[model samples]
Target: MRIVEEPFGKGVVVKPIGRLDSTTAPAAEQTIRDALTRSGHRLLLDMAELDYVSSAGLRVVLAAAKQSTAANGRFIVCELRPQVRQVFELSGFTRIITIVDKRADAEL
Candidate 1:
């Protein structure tokens, strides 16, 4: 997986392309943690190009959200592909994480 990060208002928009699985989750987790720290925990995950996610990926996302919440920061995920959305829903992430349909809604 490839992670693209850029400044978005007061936060950062992180786009992850390709599959996020056990093989990729470690790197993704590090990159996301770095972005969160650099952006003061305000993160927006733009999953438009993400095609797949596994249990490892879910752990990464959950960790990020937990960290952001602990720091009193904002973390939002938007533009999920249908398959990816299903995975998140089935994993019970939809209730705990803030997910939006548009990046605009997630903008800081």
Candidate 2:
């Protein structure tokens, strides 16, 4: 996976493209953690271009969410493709994480 970051106000938006599997999940996780640490918490993950994800990828998302919450910051996932949406649902992550259908909706 390739991670592109954009800054918006107090938050940083991370856009990851390509497959997020075991091999790439660690990089993705580190990228997000670095962004959150550097930007001081608030983050938005734009997953529109992501074509695939594994459980490892999901773990990274979960970790980021937890860390953000613990730090009193917000972490949100937006623009998930249908396939990835199903994975989130199946894993019951849809209930734990804030997921929006559009990037505009993700802006708080």
TM-score attained by model 1? 0.97
Q: How many collisions per candidate?
A: 0, 0
Candidate 1, overall lDDT?
0.94
Q: List the residue pairs that clash in candidate 1.
A: none
Residues 35-72, candidate 2, lDDT per residue (tens digit)?
A: 99987789999999999988999999999999999999
RMSD of 1: 0.7
Quick one: best lDDT, which candidate? 1
RMSD of 2: 0.9
In candidate 1, position 42 carries an lDDT of 97
Candidate 1 lDDT, 45-100, residue by residue in tens = 99999999999999999999999999999999999899889999999999999999
Error of 1 at 41 (Å): 0.3
Question: lDDT of candidate 2 vs native?
Answer: 0.90
The TM-score of candidate 2 is 0.96
